[model samples]
Target chain A: MTNRTDFPPPNANQQAFPPPAAGNQVNAQNIQDALEKAVAPKVINTSNNKNDGLNKCPRCGSTEISTQPGTGMLVCHHCRYVFEVAVAVFKDPKELIGEAIGTGAGDITIDETQVTIKCQGCGAEVVVNIEGSMTSRCHWCRQVLSLENQMPNGAVPDVLLPFLLSRETAKQHIEAFAKKRTFYANSHFKREFTTENIIGVYLPYMVVDANVHCDIRGKAGDVVRKYTVGSGDNKKTYYDIDLYDIGRDFDLAIDNLTVEASTDKLNVNNKMNTNNIINSILPFDLENAVHYNGNYLKGFNSERRDTNINDLRGLVDAQVRDVARFKANSTATKYDGGIKWESQDMDTKGSQWLSAYLPVWLYSYMQVKGNGQKLLHYIAVNARTGETMGSVPVSIGRLLFVSSLIEVGLLFLVIIFFLFLVF
Target chain B: MEALFAQLLDSVDLTQVLAVFASSDEDGVGAVLLLLLGGPAFFMFTYMRYRNTDKRHRHEIETPAEMNNLQQYNNFIKHLTRQSSSTITGANDNVVSGSLLSNGGASKSFKAINDITKNFK
Candidate 1:
């Protein structure tokens, strides 16, 4: 396991950028200004504050002043003053910068203990730590700093959800999951079950919220068939179904629908990420999610949330459809047929992006076969509650027990069918 | 192919021909066979050729169990995730920059999330 203090081998051919200055920098005002900007980073063009900070062109204190991006500064058109954009100066060596990155998701300001990226719309400046935190954003900008390129080192994250539950936990989960498959599996696999390597990975996922309305219309009918062939002992019963003209409409709000976006590595959409165990470990009490802080990340390696807003669209739809189907279900015995969707009304209200380090205990073991290898990685326990979900590696002991019982059950079922048919 | 048959159908009355086929009469046998043979032969030949090619393929015969299973599973998931081939193109070269992101001491999202969720975002 890589220790926290050890930095990974940096890639060769990587371009190097300078770090921030060294000093006891104090500015309660700077801190407050940064703090306010952290939460409220956008300047309203029509609102009163639009002109609140609009003082005379500091160049000549001229009341008729305009602000625009100069080569490396915010140029006051009236006085032609060029003060470098000093706030939210990410990774660059200087706490101050010579230019403005623009009206992004937010404005960020630098501080000794943390870097605050303020959301332009909100006042929250996401503050991240230097050591373990691997992502950062203006708490206010809501625009993520971690997802972009060329961000300053250590300017990234404040906290991480470390890898916990170790390798042993994964072994147990895989063994249990495998037991159920032992009965009909090719059999050779059962005999050669050996856990040589279990690789642990923190898979990536994006959870979302959405409100949807659905309208469905369809034509359906009841089906019934009866056959009678008779000699004294050759009579048959009837098979029947009662269907209907079905129509349904439903409205639902789904929250935190998770999906994976990475092409390689561990994707939540991968078969390995089967959604079974992940779902079994779900309902992360997202409602209880607090403002993120590095302190809570004291012990955990977290994978960054690579999936952004765009990736969550389909995931949200799937989750919405799931609930929509359920909501459309009615206990009437007659409604069985295809339903066509005529229209779907959907909209998102107040989309707030959140970055939470979900907990998971993962264990992985790669097994080698004739000429290839298979990785048996397991998401063992619900990181938050330690609940065991499911497993893939079937234990020999479990296999013997399960298969023997299954074989006995099949034997009995066949016997019962034989008696009913032959007698 | 159905459309090709449909074009043959535009001027002709298929229902009348189908009615003769449905009669189960000795006199209609030849006409019924004539109507059914065309559609069935074209479809059956197409299916047989494809099935033969598939059976002759190398990978299905020689691929290892694990690799085959992984491939099948990946195909199933990409279908489920609804990721198109276009979305996957050029995905390899881009990587997130951890260093530049982690710079500026600490106002990044990792901290913001922790901070707000300290109370919950």
Candidate 2:
């Protein structure tokens, strides 16, 4: 597909970017360079920084350094300089031998983050890389991107989904989702939940890996309840509970745990920016996730994941606690009244970090808020599995009407049953 | 204050409550009779039968939401195919949601990676 000139040039990774922010922009040569990088070059040459999105040719200063064939690398236009871009090292948790149980028990060490890259904006080196992959922004000048010598394929992802469910289908999904709420939805949402306003987008997320080993010690109880008829009218009730001490150790490996990387409305702080319907649209098949080359995201809207590993530690923590809690509960269920969890001790073993791109087919809206806030509703499908999740506009009148009908129906049922008993 | 004590005493033993009824001491003793006879019996029966009922429900609920035998089989096959080829590796069995959904004897249509390519090359 021919690249659009009207839009900004693509990145070497093929991950799409929002239009350039404010004043920061890259030259035409950068776009050309990025486009050239999609298919690798036969000979290693580093001559110019052609019109690529964010890549540069180190040799003869030509921004047009094409990628080496079969390998997504930068080749010089004048001199044959072959440099392999460092990809993220993926370690699946299920493959690991031992899993840690809780948090803070491990000797944690991070790769020194002093690695810096040239900022297309300030022409200075900026630091990046927590796990892998240079970001969309230049650290020094905070520029959106400088496609000086970027190859187009660099902006493509290993896996991508073209939009499914036209705006009409998306609108329908949103409307259905909103029908139940009696209150707390935006006023304009009901009226504006139409198909005409939908836009397709690709959001970024991080799938994390960690081997968890938990040593849990807790109390579980089986509750037996019975009633004894007393002499005369005396009645007594007692709950017989059997309690015990429990300890267990199990290794758990979580694969593809996710945290959003996009800075859009569906961010950590603003769940409303994107519709929550996406949560119900579970289980996009990630098994088909190919390697990240970044060329597929051409005309669509895409955003980088703003949340980092540190930011998503809470998600991981919650997951570990859940496992521990489930384990405790399952053991306690051997008796009754469910188990009362008195205390828990957990630890984290070894964590493996991977950056993978998951596929989504989204149709959504962005509504401006009171103080320049934006709220959005989405009808999204897991492009790989067609698992649809969506939110629609709910009309107050419709909700009240439906609620009254439900109430009336319930009242009718109660009356019918009452009459049945009476008759 | 008197009401609280009466309730407390009522909770502890039923003989006195029954004695009060036999004696016809209170005007609203009628309400107490119905509750004393009705509520406890219902609760006891439910508690006694909880295990069998709970097990039955758990077993029945796991059945896929929408499918006859043939349709469910087809859906399962389709799901497996999508999983094999789709880029959505996360859409595997691990996730509870979006696993299987069928309607009226037909299998759910899942999106899958139609084309195959190696990792981000």
Candidate 3:
């Protein structure tokens, strides 16, 4: 909350650059003024450039803009103005297909870790270290500078899904989730649990849309005779089935298959952190995602895509195969007895991989058991759909004790019934 | 042959059987009432028999109709699959990849591709 500066004397650029606009209708001059306010005030660099991640407020000339809580538009802190960024659409299906099956890795492949941007307010050069961060506070003027443009390092994605759940709403959801599991939850966990400690994060993911052609060959069965053999204690049931070769070929159009772009988050091995808890909250509204703007990530934590498209291609293919199998199996639900798929082949005719950031509010804990083993637990709420999921550590002894009491009570009732019947 | 026929007729004793019922005793009336009323036990047994018979008849009528409906649904799925084959032929030429790079402009052809692909799923 400190707004003090010791780097340099304040200049004209340090003053609120663009005065608030008089009315609602924004024009070319307003945007130019906003850009000038975001960059050096004296420099006139006008070249019709695209604003992929840079967000400047045309109304107030304030760079302290963030995604308005529970809304899709960005709000300027200085002027209380709301606005939206233009989303890019891929209209060509063929282009998607090529990129899906493309031999190249992906579109943006930069590996730079640092960049210097000149402060628009004071004409001061500010070096921003983006090693594990997306935004930095200006050292001289206390202005928040964010990654506002697309770069080669793949730090910025093509799309951004702003948070729809505010921090307060997320805290309430987390508390309610923990309250339900408190009966068998470890006492230590209950004592230490705090929803205020939650962090809002924008995790990286790749949204894939595919036009697939599937060919499935398998053997299915029909139950002809379902009869019991033997009698009483020796009785056993058997099924006599008739099997036949079945094949199906169909074209499928799939939209929005999300895969984790970070390697650490994708690792679901329970021996480590509760990584599966995050993966379980997936399936964001990729369809409604808007263009990327660093302003959306101003107040929250963010991660860059470390895993490449080629690295996660196998996972995507497996997901496509699973979906295709599910569709093919729909026709065979009539085989109530049982059906087995011997083989299936899915050919990807077209697929498009797009990069985006999805919002999540997460509260994580490390639950250490009596056996000296440590386990991580997380309760996460999806920012867009408000879907929540978590793993709560429970006391095994407590559960066993409750179950045993119920079993003893049932046994006592059985004894009383037998005694009454004999009398 | 006449003596043999007489012997067979005498063994019947029709008058002896009539004397036992026509004596007008109380036991004879009771026996007649038992045969006429048939008792609650006998009625219950007969009612259960009819109910079981009706249940078997209803089951016999329903089994075949359920089997026929399942078979009809199976046939419908096959028909749908067959009809979809024709639509697959014209899809190859329309196959194209969508791009975020060209998102700034509104291309009618791209919108057409998106519309067509969305319809298939």
Candidate 4:
């Protein structure tokens, strides 16, 4: 079996990932030079396959490099040196935004689920399965193989947020959350709740940075006078509010606004799984995000982005408008009474889109209804920050019984008040 | 749509609705007060009841075999504020200058969000 090359053949029209520069200056041609610089000029892994691993230690030329768990750093066992992965950056952020908005999600149509790659280490023909795993091991040389370049099915992301929190830390957070939520949670859930069930996963997300122009027109209320009229049954409070037409215009630079890039986790209708709870744990530190490396995904489970940028355009637009409205409201907080925003328009000046894999620790429990309908309740903790949120399945009978008693007590108090007045 | 409108029109009974509210000790006023103040509390309780009833028979459960779950979302507003403050301060003027159409930066692109010139006396 012949060995595969390290990177895919460079596409003429595709954008390039800008390499780290001396002055941080970037242009389209510089980006191409950086891309070439990041991949080539040395040990060609003799493999012509696209899915072969590129984990060779650049220092000692040894293939014993592996990613250190909890930290995304690739450590070489042979040379005892750390290798830095190259992050892809564009020359102009504006061009990135234009491409994202102009091109729909169907940019690449990859029909094949697998790629044939011959291992450079042992000349063994290793079949890289894109459907499930990103990497494989050569049966002959026992060297780890990886998918080195961007795949057509969008398996490899532009960047990734590595897991910073250790397995022990994630376990502690999960255990604490389960213990705190055990009171109202289903009995079965409590019985099944164990720290052993918590697992680390890299979920797909789209990181968006934008320069937005927003215009908002609305009516705001300025309070003039307040007075109390009448008493007892005829008691009334009146306010004279002066209304004025208000408008605001501003340019906003938004960064690291993330959206779910996969459809399975984005599904809101799934009663069995609290998928929204998983979404609530976003806002990963995109600045700390590193260049995509297959070695970093060695031990963890990762989901590739199945959904496209076009599918989430409407959602991102709504979020942008929401942020714009919020910013406008900040300026008008002096109108404490309230402002009713009637019309809002947000125009995209420029934007950037990059796909990433964010880390998460998750534990879920399933509760079935009497009618055999199953619902999955999820408790998720941000693997990095240890912040926790979950949907706990609770007993309706107990809650209803308690609430009804309270309602009855309130009715009794009302009846007593009426009797006292009559007397 | 026609059927829905017809059904809604047929369901309206002003006198019957008034009588039900009037049955309360303080007449319709007490019912109105209850609706205005206690509606949310009652609705929350009803929602809990429904959720509780629905989850009584859940069966197969699946979760991760190892502890890898949730991460805290950073404050995005803080990031936005920092970036805009930099623009105002011209901190990244070089980068901004390189990107803008005429090297004028964000100033040329600014437009009033709510233009209220015509309505003023």
Candidate 5:
């Protein structure tokens, strides 16, 4: 067991729990203490309040800021000066000791949608409706004021991944994907399909890093001999098998396991909507994610993180166990007859959670009536990697007709072949 | 009456029936069966192709390729043979014991942190 003292201290911005007061001992009591403390919410202050009230260009103090497409720099429209945001740094997965959550990842303590900010330019109070936009202009000085501070209402996140793909590029990707499925697409959908409705949106996600240990005990079988018995029609084959008691013990360090933080996106009810289509475009380049800035969201729309770390704890544990099971199964390939896991255990030594705003270009269409159920279709493109996936409403009648025609054509060929053989 | 039945049976040609069947081999029977079932099979195949396009990604089932401190144990047990038609019983295959978090209700035996030193013992 690794000593708790040997690990480095927690970050200056992060709050460590339980104090590790028991020193280097690894006992049931220490483990229990850590578990109890881990459940208690601890926030990491990731807010940068240097330019809290106003997001201005350092060169000319201009608030007209927007992200440069396919780049990490924020360009000022007035001065044309570009400011580069530093990429956010996180603890290494292997070094993670206990639960450390960002302040933005905390639960929604307040339900206030409208926030009043005192504009530094004119000292006039301006109400910024955070539900609709994070930035609003002051009527007195016409100076732009943005919400740069972390809000307990879950509006701000620890980091944000700027959109790497332009709107035009995402539109092209979506159009090309839809064109391939146009043959079987619903007639109503095809007639109304347009790329002009596509929008650039920042989706909420929780990025996790975990250190886990897994133990598994199971029974496995291997085939030894195979033979057939009895006569023609009654013949049967059997196997002589060898069984074994298998066990695997290992440690895993998982890095950047992303899960949806929005409740609406996590609802994968295939009957209601094609929400999984949005999840398909995963594996964003999170390493390039910069510290959160409201200027990056000037033109894009974003969804707030409604789920807290406690809510996602169970999901994270399940996914970690799944990963551990997958690892253990890979080593049991020698078991030709397969293995049955009788005892499976996964112990998360430590985990770190951070909230993020991931970029996605989305195009949606609702099918009013299909099979007596309405389904909302989505075509999502990963704004960072250009990975495109979508669901297109299909015409069942046309599909059935085409399939039947092909089957009939094949049957005719088979009959002709039989006739030629007879002749 | 028995003489009339015997005369009717002898009138039917058995050689003609056997000759007709023999002319068409196993391939002919297979072709006929394909023609009978090919419609539904082809329709299902095309339908599944379209359905699969909508749900092409499976990130949940995928795991990372890296690991550390991996130890494996496999002890050989007794062998037994049975005269069964199927090779696999499939009774214990892929059965994961204990409670899982994704099983909807509360889990009883699952803990995020189990006995860590149990493996060392």
Candidate 6:
């Protein structure tokens, strides 16, 4: 392999391209040959055609396929045969080279909402709205038909993490959270809060694995002498610090860094909505994500991936830089005073992108203030890890009144002590 | 017994104690001001606690297990001396702190990783 630094610089007087020779003057044949030599971007094909059109039980061949509660497996209603989608295998982060993207992570060039599938049971055609739902039941034969293939509109993803936490368990988690904050909660929110409104949802996320090389240069200081001078109000402390130049270079392999793909959920405006509450429950168990199967989404609602890989390049770059900075801290432990990073550079040697749906149980409430200003609050539970977090509207007036009372009580005690001292 | 208790109480001069508190000194005024500000402080504390419940788990980036091809360089540059009222105890003091000169928009917690590094160093 040739190192990039070993290459010689181009001469200033040299023509970028030699004047076209007699037969090579920009012709269609030359252009065609150049185009043929160009290499297309690498793609990791994750498409499975066996379960493409109509999904049926391998045993009894029933179309009634649904996920079993508390278990990450699909079950047929009639035959009761339990199975799961094939697990997706990806290359190790260190082995990743160049830019490889999963087929499902491709750009959404088409705005498609409706897809018609020919029912295998009664030979009837059914239209499944990809926007609203991916699975539909045929009216003529009553056989369930699902859209299993990856669509260009980003409705379907490469992998799906089935819900492991049941609705009942999620409700209990939300209830316990709300119970703790009931006292400071707004009056209207308290009155309307209910765990029954919680619904299981599959949120869109873009999972990335990258091979990165980082270099950081900074200045660090070490205290050589420390002493105190003067006394009373004039007391002062002084330090003689020795500064040093520090530099670190390392290679880091980052794995399974997930980012929200939907535009609505990515907008985490604290004032307008509690969307960040959803983002707080990160780091789902993406390693267990199965191959794309519509049966996993039978009873749950899902949000589609609106943003493509290009749209998320900025976010991925920033996050990768953060990870690099964090990795360099381990080797920089000798810098006692602290390191102020003057320059940080991270080069992405290779990266792979894949789209997936992660499960979450969400409960929301609208708190309307006396002035008619409203704020939406959310309580989200990670269906995989059961990690819960939420925002509750606070009753500012009530809280202030109680705090005032506490202050008055302290003042009364002070006055009583003074009186005792005087008498 | 009751008479003895009364005599013991009268032995101490309560007027002197009262005069000490009523002198209107800096310490006395400062104590009163701090007490008066307690209510507002409590209000703000409780408000932030209930409002930002989602920020409890601040660690969004997972720390990697290992780093490869590690290379380190450190060269002594010069010495700096400064005088101030603030006490400097150890290397972790405010005088010798680190920050990101570039990419200022990075999370404040990422900068805090420097503080964590100080523990091991």
Candidate 2 vs candidate 3: which has greater DockQ?
A: 2
Query: What digit string (tens of lDDT, one per residue) describes model 1 on residues A185-226?
Result: 324556765544443334344433443334433333233433
The DockQ-based CAPRI class assigned to model 3 is incorrect
Native-referenced DockQ of model 4: 0.03
Per-residue alpha-carbon lDDT of model 5 for A1-423, expressed as tens digits? 221222222236634222234433478887886677576635667886544468889899989999898775799999899778999888777766667788778778998888899989889999988876788889999888888888788889998899889988999999998898888888999999999999899999998878877777777778878787675555556778787777777667777778788878866544456676787788778888888999998888888888876666665665666666767777777788767777777777777788999999999998876335567889999999999988777677787688778778878887797799989
- Scored against the true structure, residue A320 in model 6 reaches a CA lDDT of 66
Compared with the true structure, what per-residue lDDT tens digits does model 1 show for residues B17-75? 55546543434344535444444333333322211111110111111111000000000
How much is the lDDT of residue A197 in candidate 2? 48
Query: Candidate 4 chain B — worst ten consecutive residues by lDDT sum?
Result: B56-65
B-chain TM-scores per prediction = 0.19, 0.18, 0.16, 0.21, 0.36, 0.34
> If both were scored by lDDT, which would come out higher, candidate 2 or candidate 6?
6
DockQ-best of 2 and 4: 4
Tens-digit per-residue lDDT, A246-334, candidate 2: 44444445554444433342221112333334534444444444434322232334543443344445544544454445533443345
When summed lDDT is taken over every stretch of 10 residues in candidate 6 chain B, the lowest stretch is: B96-105
Kindly indicate the candidate among 3 and 6 with the higher lDDT.
6
What tens digits encode model 2's per-residue C-alpha lDDT throughout B1-121?
A: 2123223322433444445455442233444343444433332222212111111101112211111011000001111111111122221112111111211111121121101111111
Q: Is the docking of candidate 6 incorrect, acceptable, medium or high quality?
A: incorrect
- Candidate 4, A1-423: lDDT as tens digits: 111122121236632222323443458986575445333322212122334465677798766666665665778877888876664443243222222321112334775668777788878788887766778888888887888666557677777767778788888776776666454455666677677877777888776666555556656655555665666666545565555556555556566667777877655432334565675565566677776777777667777788766556555564555555666665666554466676666656456566777888777777776667677767777766666666666654554465577677667767777788789
Please identify model 3 stretches exceeding 4 Å from their true place: A1-54, A92-95, A100-112, A224-230, A240-242, A410-423, B1-121
C-alpha positional error of residue A103 in candidate 5 after TM-score superposition, expressed in Å: 0.7
lDDT of 5: 0.70
Cα lDDT of model 3 overall?
0.56
Q: Which has the higher DockQ value, candidate number 3 or candidate number 6? A: 6
Arrange candidates by lDDT, descending. 5, 6, 3, 4, 2, 1
Query: Highest lDDT among the candidates is held by which one?
Result: 5
Residue A127 lDDT, candidate 3, scale 0-100? 72
**Candidate 4 runs further than 4 Å off:** A1-51, A58-72, A76-97, A100-108, A270-272, A404-423, B1-121
Residue pairs that clash (backbone atoms under 3 angstroms), model 5: none
Ranking by TM-score: 5, 6, 4, 3, 2, 1
